[model samples]
Target: MNSRAAQLQAFDRLLTIMDELREQCPWDKKQTMQTLRHLTIEETYELGDAILDNDLEEIKKELGDVLLHIVFYAKIGSEAKSFDIADVANEICKKLIHRHPHIYGDVKVKDEADVKRNWENIKLREGKKSVLEGVPKSLPALVKANRIQEKVAGVGFDWEEPHQVFEKLREELAEFQQEVKSNHKERMEAEFGDVLFSMINYARFLDINPENALERTNKKFMERFQYVERKAKDIGKSLQEMTLAEMDVFWEEAKTMDKRF
Candidate 1:
């Protein structure tokens, strides 16, 4: 078989297995969309974590888990007479053909930016009230901010220079500092949020994903903390027994080790 035929066969096999499991397996038979929603989210995050770690094997496993959730949801929808796997797949296929007019039709795009602009324009033509309407409210704030900024930029609303973003960042930071000095808890919280928003916007100006960058820092801190904990154990000292100066010695060593990694 050709590669495409082989892929179809593989997908068919998964479908067959899904049907059998739904009918025969007690746990699989019992699952509903509501019960599986959190699992789907967790699987997506695992896929993201795998990508961040550069672990292709884990990514593959996580992807399979996510795919299973997709099929499972389709199965449930079929049971409700709403939709099925073929409907799900064909709807996306239709969307791809609709969105990529440069390839599927005569629409000319100059570059990737043009392609992105076309995509947002297409969404608008498809009857979306606002570009931001497509963004899920459940998305984490950092990711949501990035999406909002990108959506606006797609329609030509953005700062022209990174220096302009830097100016905004400095202003937000100064406001936050003033709030800190004033010691007004509610205003301080609001100013702190403004600081974070400005920082995320500046990071976007520099082509940095704030969410990914923060997650990477979180992982680095986790690894360095584990290293410190191990060293403390070797010296028969709990973290509580160690002074800040002593922990700094291990923290510095961990930094050196991190460079090697």
Candidate 2:
């Protein structure tokens, strides 16, 4: 069979297995959307980690896990006579087609930036009261900041240049320093938030995703830390017993070895 047909057949098999599990597996039958919410979030992070690690096999497996969650949710909805898998697929298909007017319609887009601008304009035209309305409240703070900036920038509200964003970041940092010196707890917290927000804006100005940047740092730290642990074990010293100087040596070595970053 052709690739598309093979994919469809695989999807059909997954759906069939889901149906059997719902009917015959006690654990699967007992799952509710509320219970699965955290699992879905965890699966998403696993997929992200896989992507960041460049582990295609892990990414494929994690994607299947996420897809199973989607199908499971659809199955639950079907049981309740709310909606089915086809409805879920149709909704996203319609959304994709609607959003890509430049692809499916005669809308002219000069570049990726223009496409983003058009997307925001189309979303506004779709009756959304605010550009920020679609941002999930549960999103990580850095990601939320990035999304908020992008949404506003879509409508022409943004810094003219990266230097302008950098200046703002510096200003916020100065204010945060002042708050720290004054020991005003509440004001310090607010200023700290402003500093982070400005940093996120600077990240956006440079066409960098703050969340992905942070995640990459997180992974790098974990890898270096594991190296430290392994080195300490090899030398017959526990991590807790290792000196700061010794750990720093291993950390610097890790930084040198991790040339890809």
Candidate 3:
């Protein structure tokens, strides 16, 4: 681990490199925040995958990538005479101090929920029109739904019990089933979305991140299916040539292998 002084020196080195690149490197020089936006998003997902895999080395590398993107954006901001890295860093520092009254002020909190309630209330006092105002409009539906539930919950707008959330989920499922029976395509779609929203809320009550859980299942399925494909190829058979039973055998093997690993 680096000392605090060493850490600050390393960050200064990064800023120097960024400045050189922005001045001398043609690609870096031509880059704007808008031009780097999609790349930043891709790097973020890479970091997410690293975190999910619990790969410390990969996580460290991804963090550097993300930090570089931050520096790049800050450089662009400085060039435009808008703001620089210090301004960006200070703004968040101020926000954190303001929001955490329990830590920075005389406010007392009994639990994590109390802290959250204070944070949301502070945001409102900071001139936010609604609790949901901070949730990005461009977030994926599943992630957005979770954020919406969380923000409202922070302000005490939530079910009193986990079982109540489960009951709502069940009700939504019943409505979805009714829509399916009616065979109205549009209504069924709407009902299906409601079911998903309810499920996300229920997952929140269970302390599970629905996005991470779903992505883990997706990765698991891909690995197992790929294992099945490899087994079929070893026997000189394509997946299309393998019967369901044959694939199931490899799938079972993959499951066993996963358990061992």
Candidate 4:
């Protein structure tokens, strides 16, 4: 096992470097919590991209970038005579001990689902107004819907099985199609949103992260499209100059090389 004291020393080194940079580096001295917000979000996405690509080296670098942001924020807090890095770390540490009664106390849990239930129940006891209140409002719609469903399901407010979710999805889709045929744009939009929300809920029933799954499909489509473009170049043609039939030959060939196949 790793030495825990060595890990603390490594973090202390980061804090020391942050201190030096704040005092000496012109750009570092200027950043505030508000100014760093967008950069932190961008760094987070880069880390996500590295994870999805399965590039361990890129993952390490992106993780460092995000860690730097954490230390930076803590340093800013220290400057304002507020909570610092130690406070941030200790707060989460205390929360973990509070939330994980199975480890920290005598509470018994039979499975992962029971643990999740306990976690939500513990939050309610800790003064959270609602389980849904924990979901970030800025989350992408599909991901947000999945999270909302999961939070409510923790308290037993959910369909019993995947088939019921699928049935609800089909109902929503039918309503959307009816509105489309009627050419009622506003009603169609509302119905379309319902269809999407139902589909996300169904995805949750399948134990899928809809956002990650869709991004994976998006990556597959991009790779196949790029391959089709390369094949067209080899044939002295461009996509704009080719008929659908001509382009689809390359598309089909690309599909044969797909990772799943």
Q: How many clashing pairs per prediction, in order?
A: 0, 0, 0, 0
* lDDT tens digits, residue span 121-234, model 1: 899999999989989999998899889989988988889999999999999999999999999999999999888888898999898989889999999999999999999999
Taking all chains together, the TM-score of candidate 3 against the true structure is: 0.98
- The Cα local distance difference test for each model comes to 0.93, 0.92, 0.95, 0.93
Model 2 residue pairs with clashes: none
lDDT of 2 by residue, 1-261 (tens): 369989999999999999999999999999999999999999998998899889999998999999999999999999999999999999999998999998998888888889888888889899998889989999988888889999999888888989988999999999999999999999999999999999899988887888889988988899899998988988999989978999999989888889866
Best by lDDT: 3
What would the C-alpha RMSD of candidate 4 be, to one decimal place?
Answer: 1.6
- Off-target runs (Cα >4 Å) in candidate 2 are 259-261
Number of the top-ranking candidate, with TM-score as the measure: 3
Worst 10 residues of 1 by lDDT: 1-10
**Residue-wise C-alpha lDDT for candidate 3, range 134-164, written one tens digit per residue:** 9999899999999999999999999999999
Candidate 3 or 4, higher lDDT? 3
Relative to the true structure, candidate 4 reaches a TM of: 0.95
At residue 102, candidate 2 shows an lDDT of 89
* Estimated TM-score for each candidate: 0.97, 0.93, 0.98, 0.95
Residue range 160-183, candidate 4, lDDT tens digits: 989999999999999999999999
